[model samples]
Target: MTAQRSGAGANDGSTHRPRVAVFRPDDDRLRDAVALLDSLGVKPVADSMLAVEPTGALPRDDAAFVVFTSKTGAELVAEEWTAGEETVCAIGEPTAAALREHGISVDVVPETFSSTGLVDALGDSVDGSRVEIARSDHGSDVLPEGLWDAGAYVHETVLYRLVRPDDAGESVRLAAEGDLDAALFTSSLTVEHFLAIADERGQREAAIEGLRAAVVGTIGEPTRETATDHGIDVDVVPHTADFEALTEAVLDRLEGE
Candidate 1:
């Protein structure tokens, strides 16, 4: 469905309908994004950029508590690991909501919803605590490092790994062809992979600067640094991880004010 709001799109003062390229995992993550885009009357080109690969490791049933950094991580843990007496700590509301849907009550949902946010929210409770952190193999070291420093006994399980999907390059090509008015990055990994694909297509600078950027939380913060290096000004950031907020960020950019 093509969603075009009147007087929204392009900075040239033309009434062009804005099209946005979305690079997210192809689960509810992508679905929810599309739903929000539809509600906002903005067209979205849904593109799957990352796929989750299971590592065949489950969270230890005997752990004191468990930490989930992403919705995918929570989903994987909920699927393979039975709920014990462990308190679940979900890094973000989306991840926490995913766990709650499975009859799980999350003990903590951080304000920032990042690794550092998780550590900070857990506070001294993490001290002398045995926490099992489930995330991708290539995830940031902030959680483990913070837990260790806080005197927590950290047991980490690589529940999944993120692999670049084959269609990502095509999505980058579509963006480079001026088919996209904006690009929304929900994760830093997406930013890295998108830039890599653009670099491979030999228009990394143009792709980085030519389109408007809307980021979610700190996920898109790192991308802004990269975009700034290419002289691209980031247009908006939801600062919250919610898809609805992200949709608004896109709408704000589409209006070109």
Candidate 2:
């Protein structure tokens, strides 16, 4: 069942409408999440951690396989993909669909949307193969490293750069005022960039203390360590490391507490 909260400006007076800060890049995912929050009478403020920009280059290598881990990555490839010799692999359904939308057929798609999941799905397939991974400039080294260890000749290229958002000043001001009830961190990059913005504005500690946090929840040791280093206690992390899971976890935590 879909959970509902009741409070002033919410469904009823019993539940308070919480203002959530979204610390993601300005993209479709962020827009969808914001719309969902609006439907629930919750206010969502954009504290975008990164801004995306295209790197003008077409992927040309007719490699054995191509890998994509995010919808943005897939879209960037589709913008310049014109080869027929390579098979495409996606980390999630959305990325696969993006490829299909570009009239490209995906050869492999992991059931889960994590790097570990992708590695498991590609287990023996990548051995002795040449795979090209297209992703953001600031992505993790998990996929490339794992593939290399498994005997694949992995080639990587950055298709986009995640820069700090231009309106970050407004976000910092709002956070300083304690207007945001909570902030969602979907990636370690989001956590890092958000803190960087806070630190630049001289409001790091206050921002951390004021807002409740929920991470998209990585199983990676490094992700957990990064969160800890920033002094941000992760309030809720779902079993599945996806945005839907993150939302449910946040809602459950807010309802319970």
Candidate 3:
């Protein structure tokens, strides 16, 4: 179903609908993002920057608390594993929902949906517990390190590897030409991959300049920091680190501008 147009704002001064860049994997997520943007009356440039390569491994079976950092991880684990007696922990509601889809009961979901937030949420309770973290190979060291520092015996399983797709730079081309209106970056890796593709195309400087002219929104502080570190001015970061929140904030910012 199409979402209604956000009435008469960013498009007022332009002939065509604003073209926003989206960098989700070419799957249901990408389809949903494009649909959402279309519903908002914006043209979506769907450039999938990431591709998943599963490791064919499962989370360790002995931990007292098993942690899932993403919906992808939760779904992967559920394929061949069960919760058993362990307390299942998800980094956010999406992951929790994925776990539940597999009939796994989630015991914890942090108030904040980040590694640091999960560490804080587990708190003193993990002081003497065994925590198993299952996620991508490129996952941040923050979760494991924090749990280790908090006195939990932490084990990490790389369920997959996030690789940049070879042909994922259409958005970079659009940004370099100043034809794009906005970008929604969901993670630091997406920001990094976008820039890497720009550099490869020898349009890195031009793309950054074009992005500066358009609205750029990141899903969280870390993603915002990544964009800023690469000289792209980030216009918005939603309070919740999710795609829906990032999309709404960005559209709102575009309307206000």
Candidate 4:
């Protein structure tokens, strides 16, 4: 089926129908965002960029505090710990809600839903605490480093690996042909994997040239720095790194353009 547009005024004759392409894999966030786009009367084209794979075994010890930055991380931890002695700290409300659904009450919910937000909310609790971070294998070291800096004994268990999707080559090819108006990248891995796919399809430059790219409304300095290094002109980044904010950023950028 053809993708649907969302939100009125997206194509109200004054402006052209804006098309925003999402590079997230099949997940709840992507589905919800697409629904929102449809409500906004904007067409959304999806190309799976990252595939989450369960990586290693969970830690045996009952963690003092379990930290999760992404919903995927929370889900993995929930699967491992049917009932545990850990107090969960989530970076965002949605992830906290996800944990709550699994009978886990989050002890700390960050105000901003970013890694820095987690650190800020954690405060003294992180110091001298035994914290376990559940995340993908290729995630950033910021969380662990921040915990360590706070005097916490932090251990990271790889719950999953973010790998490039199998159909990424075809997606890159399509983007290179200007089939997409803008491509949304939510993570550094998304940026890396998308470029890798483009390279494999021998359309790296074309893909980059054909479409504008936007990062998840909020990202770390390192992620932004990496994007700049790769010559990607980031069109939008939300003040907070949440799906809703990211969607708004997309809409605003589309309107501006």
Please tell me which predicted candidate would have the highest lDDT against the true structure. 3
TM-score order of candidates, top first: 3, 2, 4, 1
Q: Whole-model Cα lDDT per candidate? A: 0.72, 0.72, 0.88, 0.70
The number of residue pairs in model 3 that clash at the backbone is 0
Tens digits of per-residue lDDT for model 4 on 11-60? 55544555566767678766886777767776766777788787655644
Q: What's the TM-score of each model vs. the native?
A: 0.83, 0.86, 0.94, 0.85
Worst 10 residues of 1 by lDDT: 212-221
- Report the C-alpha lDDT of model 1 over 87-166, residue by residue, as the tens digit: 88888887898888887888888889677888888888878879898888877777899999988999888999998897
lDDT of each residue in 223-250, candidate 3, tens digit only: 8888899899999999988999999988
In the order shown, the candidates' Cα RMSDs to the true structure are 4.1, 3.3, 3.1, 3.8
Estimate the lDDT of model 4: 0.70
Query: What is the clash count for each candidate, in the order shown?
Result: 0, 3, 0, 12
Name every residue pair that clashes in candidate 1.
none
**Poorly placed runs, candidate 3 (over 4 Å):** 1-4, 7-15
Error at 9, model 2, angstroms: 3.9
RMSD (Cα, Å) of model 3: 3.1
Q: Candidate 3 — which pairs collide? A: none
How well does candidate 3 score on lDDT at residue 232?
Answer: 90
